[model samples]
Target: MSAGLLVAVLLASALLEGSGWAGGVGDGNLRLSVTVNGRADSDVRPPEVRVGTWVVKRYRLLNVSEADLHRVRVLDPGAPAGSVRCPAVLPAAEEAECTARFRAVAGRHVHPVRAEGDVPALRTRLTATARAGYAGVAGALGLTEEVVVATPGTGGGGASAIVTYTVTNRGNLPLYTVRVEDPGLALAPGAPDCGGRGGTVAVLAPDTSAFCRTTVRLRPGTYRSAGRASGSDRATTLGTGGERVTAPVLTAGASAVFVVREAPVAPVPRTPAPGAPAAGSSAGAAGASAGAGAAPAPGAPGALARTDTGTGTGTGTGTDAAGRPAAPAAPGAGAAPGAVPPGAVPPGAVPPSSVSPGAVPPAPPPGLRRAAGVDDEGFLGRVRRRGREAAEFGVATTLLLLLIPAAVAAALLGSRRK
Candidate 1:
């Protein structure tokens, strides 16, 4: 029962439960209680509801007598019309209950309820009170909040960015099943298990908070992230954050390239005809001089050498065993002047016994002049000059050709003397 009804019952029992009614007897007393809307009718402070609300009151009667009660009846005549229910017969030592309700009008009012019955040689009357009023209930439910956001962690190029959100419930009531969200940060397969993502919080009491961390993979471009908290309401904005991404760089080292072009070729020196002057000899000097006269002598600076191969006896002299001319031998390389090792001939002569009587020595090839040292280019130069002159004179300019030849011959004879 309501506090009002319980209070009303206690008050009625304290006031009238012990009063003796007839014949000095203590066994036939009446006890009564009254309540309104399950609350004690005698409560000093009853909960007030607006007008037109029903005010239901109930009255209970206990016989408390030695013998049976007859023709029992309960009444609340002080209540509004059509608002009473009384029991017709209630036995002695037994209890009975009745109820009444009235549409509350705009006023402060008090109502009295009563019970009456007859016991053997005793008559009885019981009474209680119910109070009600038309007043309004007043109170308010208000909510306020705050949010904190953590800076996002660095995400390497082509990697995921991570952000954290802390949502605080600064409301008067506890918030249940708190959740967090980020519009720009999509939920990913590998999002961290950091408390508030897809998870729930049992309670976020007033002035308390929770954290939600999320990780997402981002492509190579600048992006923005916005954070918020949600539960019973749509969503309260926590804060906003940002993330950026970039690409990679590569480099190559040294390299090479090639180009092609033709180069001028130096004229190769031609071998002199066999009769051309020995290299570095006066014939080459004379030829060189004939072009300008008074040329420097044989063996002059810058003269090139001609190589020679012989020992007078063309067969065994400078020939190797296979009969090829041996490379020019240095001095002191063969047997000493007069000391023949074996099967050797002396230099400068052939034994008459080995020669046929009428046989003539073979003439040396045309340009094969002997010299201590030779000039290959000088010999070539002399041959070139003779050719140029012969071309110039032919048989008509014989004197010019004759003079140059005679001059070259003289120079050759002079070089032989030296």
Candidate 2:
């Protein structure tokens, strides 16, 4: 029944059912629903059509039952006039979509068409609201559930939605096939359950207040849901509920949601004093030079003048300008670019021969040099284009060697048909 019919039935159910809950109890209190709408019956102009013209029809079906629907069917009336197939049925309360294709030939006319189908005793009706050239019509099943209910949930990291359903037998009648129909949750490839069906999961029982759980990628908002329960004898919607969802939770390792968030680092500001020397330098003061009376600079400035500036490598005992070990000198680091010959050392400075040897690096493989002036992108592109050209040539050759000649021979032997 469509929503309109459902409302009418509900208003008069008490009379027909012989008291509410006394008669008219269906499959679990859930019944499947179907709806269609779009450019079918509009009166802007007469339905216009062309030769070999094609028309696309869109349809959506919502299970609207707590139990997942299996093998639902939708029959379109415009069919025999040349129609395609019906999309599969959605699970209980869940919805499935299907499209039908039709051809309209120009200068041709069609009579008003209508469609109908039967789900056992439940009957569905479809009628043309628009023609080939006009807008379409809208339709749906009418089953008014007195009590409106909704439930929403959330998940993250590809976790299944944990939904719990309570099926209680408030009345004396025994509920036979108590089940749940779940709409799929949005999930990405990397999620834990990505490879499996997050669409519909079924759990059936006769227990009072049964629980149903589903893990969907967590979204933040409210979700609307309705359910139907019944015995094996019939199909009717019984009860419905709603739920809400929230954001993902982050934790540690693969087993749980945990990522250790380190505290942010802060910059250390320098002191803004007049003449205070910088910290972290060797602790010393600038005193007078050994000569007569060289005024000593203050603090650290005085310390540098007193330190050795040269190596000692003269004769058997090499000597530097400051008379320190030759190994201590690093004049090349301070030398102007190109000031010294390649491999030449400053006076008393240690040469490469004097340094301690470590491991020698292996030589380059035989053909490991960069291709001269050959940019990687340009080279790769050319190679790819050459391969494509070769492929084209091969195809051309094969066609000339096989297909074309065969086609020519076939043509020579033509007129045998017709």
Candidate 3:
């Protein structure tokens, strides 16, 4: 062949090799096809999807040549690693499939899928590519609101309550300019903290929540309050110029019921009741009168004059009929001190003038003795008498012990001297 003709032939052969068609005779080849959202690429229109929705991509690979394909791989940039499922080896004249998934975003999206394999019999590589397209639209706007109230305990005047509002985005799109409002109550200062700048929650993403808290004063009664949350799908301001756009507002509401009670009162104390005179004064007056008027029976105790009945004359010196000094009266007895009643002085009784004023009174006759601890000497007086006697006995015993030792020493000295 001529040199010019040979150059042209070589150029044609290079192009065929670069295009994977040089050794097309009996060499293995792969055909790749892709679908987006279950719609094939040859369809007239692409699949329409909502933003944040799942976009499913399917890849089909066919071994068109007479030889089997080995070490096959399917790759998609939009899908995560190990998410594309495909067989490692594909038989001749057979088809293999792969599936991958990704989330859709606002605007049109194009995804390219690639299939590659090794042809061992021909010692060559085969590659094929296909693309799928989908269009994304704006999602629905939705919201949910919840209100919680913390009521105060019993208090004076009206007490403050802590009100919390929880707003949640329940749809696939983000919400903007979220705010809470209550018509029946006024919020306190430095309140409505929604974890945003200036106590406002500007945005809430899909399926997420934001909390706002405020304070309000409530009286002592049952209160029912409702709170509404409103948000829009687009931001109110678009650019640096502060241009405002009107968007559809979505609202949700919830109500809370709570009660506040009143404080309790204290009680007052009572006064005591009235009654009688003391025993000492009545007994002394009765004793003086009875000493002059009557005497008790010989072996019987005297009956006390009734002071409450006003029957006795409470006057006169405390002396017996024979002019002897009287014995002291017992408390509450009201009897004459030492006077004997008419038949009380026995026939042979001693004369009063014979006994001195300071002399001790005679003991009662045999069967009329007083009980133990009931003597005329008071309990404190008896205690004093016993204490003096104990002191004297102790002193005498100590002197005797000293004298006995001295006597024994003196006796020993005298014996030695003799």
Candidate ranking under TM-score, highest first, comes to 3, 1, 2
For residue 45, model 2's alpha carbon misses the true position, in angstroms, by 6.1
Q: Which residue pairs in candidate 3 collide?
A: 295-340, 295-341, 296-341
List residue ranges in candidate 3 displaced over 4 A. 1-130, 133-158, 168-175, 183-199, 203-210, 235-247, 250-252, 265-388, 397-418
Best-first order by lDDT = 3, 1, 2
Better of 1 and 2 by TM-score: 1
Model 1 spans with C-alpha error above 4 angstroms: 1-28, 120-418
Query: Top model by TM-score, which number?
Result: 3
How high is the lDDT of residue 265 in model 2?
Answer: 38
| Alpha carbon lDDT of each predicted model | 0.49, 0.36, 0.64
lDDT of 3 by residue, 206-316 (tens): 778887777666667777767667777762311112233344567788777777565433345544345444455688768777875875433344454422222222432
Off by over 4 Å in 2: 1-47, 67-71, 106-418
- Tens-place lDDT per residue, model 1, 295-350, is 43323333233334545353434765667877754322343333323333334434
Residues 277-332 of candidate 2: C-alpha lDDT, one tens digit per residue = 55643243232123426543222123222233453333323457665544443333
